[model samples]
Target: MGRSDVRPSRSSPLAWGVLGLWLLVVVLALPLAGQLGESTEDEGVDYLPASAESTEVARLTELLPGGDTTDLLLVAQRPGGLTAEDRALVERRLERIDALFDVAAGDPAAAGVVSGDGGTALHPFSLGELGEEEQGQAVGEIRELIADPPQGLTLALGGPGALGVDAEAVFESIDVTLMLATAGIVAVLLVLTYRSPLLWLLPLFAVGVAAVAAMALVNGLVSWFDLTVTTMSSSIMTVLIFGAGTDYALLLVARYREELRRLPGAGEAMAAALRGCGPALLASSGTVSLGLLCLTFADLNSSSGLGPVGAVGVLCALAVMVTLLPALLVLLGRRVFWPLVPRHGESRATGRDTFFARLGSSISRRPVTVLVGGTLLLGALALGTFRLPGPLAEQDNFTETPASVRAMELVADAFPERSGQPIAVLADADHAQEVREAALATDGVAEAEAGREGGGWREIQVFATDPPESEGEQATVDALRERLAELPEAKALVGGPTAQTMDLADTASHDQRLVIPLVLTVVLLVLAVLLRALVAPLLLLAAVVASWGAAMGLGGLVFGPVLGFEGLDAQVPLLSFVFCVALGVDYGIFLMHRMREEALNGADTRTAALDALRTTGGVIASAGVVLAATFCVLAGMPMVVMAEMGFVVAVGVLLDTFLVRTYLVTSASWLLGRRVWWPGPLGRRPAAPGQRAAVDAVPAGAGPRGDAG
Candidate 1:
């Protein structure tokens, strides 16, 4: 239990080679990593459900005359009423807008309209087909052109086009901001955990190398395989590399430090450390990578794209942590630990294992009480889900209200009966008239009109009687789809901003149902194989799942009442669950694997459990804190989706680490004893007196000694 048996000095040449190879990879990765942001796309088609009606419409819309068009509403208002000067200023601004930008050919508001309340004037226009980049530029220019309105006249730009511009701004800045913030968080945590300024730099540097390499590789995937990379996916990838990479470093380094006490040389000690903890590292990485890859089955394009992007990150972190990190550490030798370096033949009974040993003893004294208490606590926390808010609306996606959202509010106040964004219905040109008539006849339709025709398809712009994303608006969209479906050969598709949001939300729900089970199954099978037991994997799986529920419930409690967020994003639940199950299971693997090793070495069940907890607990706790803090970096992001995801996953990791893995799993193991490994060789009681016993069937350390409690 004190130290691993050291092998010959075999790591010198391998370490040097790994170091050399990593230096080269890092050099090549720098520029490519910088270019990764350029490849990310935040377009509607990039995030919409692949097979949804909204996605198809988005695709076909690009085939129209001006590429994909953007619509905008220019609003000018005064609280009391619009005066003559206000109208004149608005008129001049409208003329300037028309002259500067290529307005769509046919617009109802080519000339501005005054509201009946006499306090507002609205002008609606669409930019002629422009690329995504060009669209953002156009919106920016328009905002600048109409920067400050005359006194008493409030001029604001509002529409889907303006909203996209605002969102793209956030997306553009996310990469640099996220990387810096995540690095800072990890650096701080590592320094605190290691209590060594010098040692912290090595893991942080190695993780940074992994991040750059992952980014370069991900960008290559985008270019070659047409993988979708969104700002959120790319940001999460950076977090995964840093978080998972640092966790691996902590586990490996802790084991190496332990080996250092018994082994004479650093090279020999590192080899033993790698031998001891390598399986857990590989299993941990594999579980996370495969769990994320399950996102490929998600209907949402963003969710599916994140699968490979995140998997690539975890794999890159694994590669670098095992090879580059170990190589660097081995070459640096024991002094790299500085101030508190481990020496040969040092005492094994340091304070490191004492706390966890005492904890294990306490839990073992009343295992059933501990187990039942933990379960009830998790269940009570899970009830917080009932307090969760509704699905986030488009205008509420940002943590702070951008100008576009402000404009939307202003427009909504003035134009209660009209929606600034219209629902688009695409149909066969042959049946355009019939589809339009049917749409007009639909219960929620206020008006329907023919739009551009291209590529054997005709676009019909349908205005709903209700505002966008409202219950009434969604109902209208549903009614239109149903009404249009009955038309003979119409092949009509209902889509628009509202429809796209609906599709994304529905797809998220479907993805949660699909991906959660896939992630659980993948993680369970992995645990079963690793532990070589049925009962243990099931126990760990249930622990992480329950931990997820508790974390999400905590999120529900925090997101609304504490954070003041309006509602949860559609993607948060699925993404958080994936990370929680995958990453949370990591600590369970570490603790259980060590316990199994002890049992295999012929230690009694009680002693093995306590010893595993004693030896691995500190490092596991440090890894958990690092992972949790890294994820908490997401809370700094402006996007609600990322913020919520970061909060839930971070909470779940902490709960799994400090609560379930530390107490619940240990207590359960003590109670189950050999049954914890049921159906496996280790699970069986000693053979009958006459029969030969299995290799691990001896009762040398089988009894639960009272002092172990």
Candidate 2:
């Protein structure tokens, strides 16, 4: 199709109108964006499946007299046995600790338990119905209350409450930290990629607007749809906005530059650019959004919530980039390109002279060799999955060993026969005694006793003989659950910190089984519809899946050996798969779409593959680096899950960008020739000198076309 068919008028007023509209959106969204943090919750319950046993216990607890309690452990330990003086010091500290809880809504405090070894004492405290902030402050006061432990005696706070405090401390400033870090990374990468001081600012500014808008939308989702947003989801959303928005900006700007060399004015150039790349952008965002939406099928609350949260970020980025970015670029004119500006009628280097073009030529000469080598490399990397450790334990969740974790370690070592973490049994009040009796009879049970009775339920505090989160403890919990299951009248539900972790891991596995196939299907259908061919979409999907495997393999090697992570989080594999497959397919779409466009426009299979790579290669590289770097920011987070997630997605994106899209996909397409477009017109028709496909010359990819400046 002719350029005139798709181009808007050079002097259109839409650019100014679009700019004005986006400014209004920013003004309206800023306040709501601030409230987003207010809606974010990071409790264990928040991550649990709504229908899980642990979730029901958590829910039932909140309905009791004191709502939810902040349970903490005060540990006093020494290498040598406690002397009379040390015992008296522990007694005095216990009094002070009791006073701390006594002031908080007058909740009753339990007596301290001295280990048989006489070297350690564990005192459990509860602050009833405290808000998150109040809980943190209360934990702090307790720490201060026992700050002066006698020289050899080590005093530390452990238990769920202390752990929450440490975790919350890491997440408290997550949003601001993530935004600043992501923006800084994108800015640096953008400057390096574009090599123009002025050019970097436009995309950066546009992406910032997108992030603000996305946060506001997310906050609204929280209020309206009751969407769950955790620090992990929100942080990932922020990274997605900056990374994806910048990527879109890069692609559009590259296309606009190419158009500028041929078109008469900025408006027409941008209109033509948008017209060319618009479908691919829409298709790319659609694939990502739909793929994320597949997470809604997950049973885990955090995983399900992340689907919509991330989709919101991607959609907002797309809207701003397609509208606000274009308006800004058109309004600024060719001057934004500065120094490397494309002047009308200027002749420049063609694809034949470009690095990607040369690389494509070499691959085309020996397509099978490149394809086999690339596949073998990807397969080898995938073998690293065998090296991946088991589910991440609670103590291993943090990148650094917080005080709580250290305390837990001491308590575990001191009281080797007893579990510090309680296994809560929520049983029918009518049959509470029977459930308690059964729990005590379980194989791993060290102790089981009836506790709080309210809201038609009775709490049974059960302690396993094994340490918390140990394989043996998990087995005991399973045995107790089975015993309770037989007592139909009891309707007992086992929950607590350990139970929650088990449920999360189980649910994560279930989610993987359910969501993975759905995501692949959604992505496959999108590719099929977009490309209008079965074989091409299948090939793209295979390449994407292989890339994901390679990325996960790299994580297996890096996470434990290089980063000292204890083990992979239960959720990482599924989340990473969704991200790598969904987001990684983006580069594939840009390449394959452009290649099909070239094919329909009279280029043979070889020329189409080479030109597509040559045109899209530079911008895809820039976008990939920017995105990878943006996610790499998560590595600095104190949370192991976030760091692992960041590493996998970033690696997957880099692999997809530099290797899969550039070589494997290109070589495969070249070898397949027109057969890649099987069941489509291109599959049947031989290359004719003057014939163009019925479809318009749909432009995609983010690199300069040959010999046009």
TM-score of each: 0.94, 0.94
Worst 10 residues of 2 by lDDT: 700-709
Tell how far residue 257 is off in model 2, in angstroms. 0.3
Candidate 2 vs. true structure, TM-score: 0.94
Clash totals, every prediction: 1, 1
**Tens digit per residue, CA lDDT, model 1, 360-423:** 7677666777899999999999999999988787788898899999988887788778775689
Q: How displaced is residue 423 in candidate 2, in Å?
A: 1.1
Q: Give the per-residue lDDT of model 2 (tens digit) for 1-709.
A: 2344234335448988999999999999999999988899998788888779889988887676655678777788887777777767767776776665643332223336778877887777667678888889888988897798888988899878789899899888677888888888888888988888798999999998998899999999999999999999999998899988898999999898889888778888787998889989999999999999999999999999999999999999999999998898887776677667777777656737678777876776566788999999999999998888777888999888999999999988988898987898999999999998899888999999888889789988899999988889999889988999999888899888778888888898889989999998999899988888888999999998999999899988888889999888888999999989988999999998899888877887666887888899998988888888988998678899999999999999999999899999987887677878887877777767464322112134321222111
The per-model lDDT (C-alpha) reads 0.86, 0.85
Q: Candidate 1's error at 165, in angstroms?
A: 1.2
Which runs in model 1 stand beyond 4 Å of their true positions?
A: 1-11, 106-110, 129-134, 350-353, 685-709
Candidate 1, residue 205: lDDT: 90
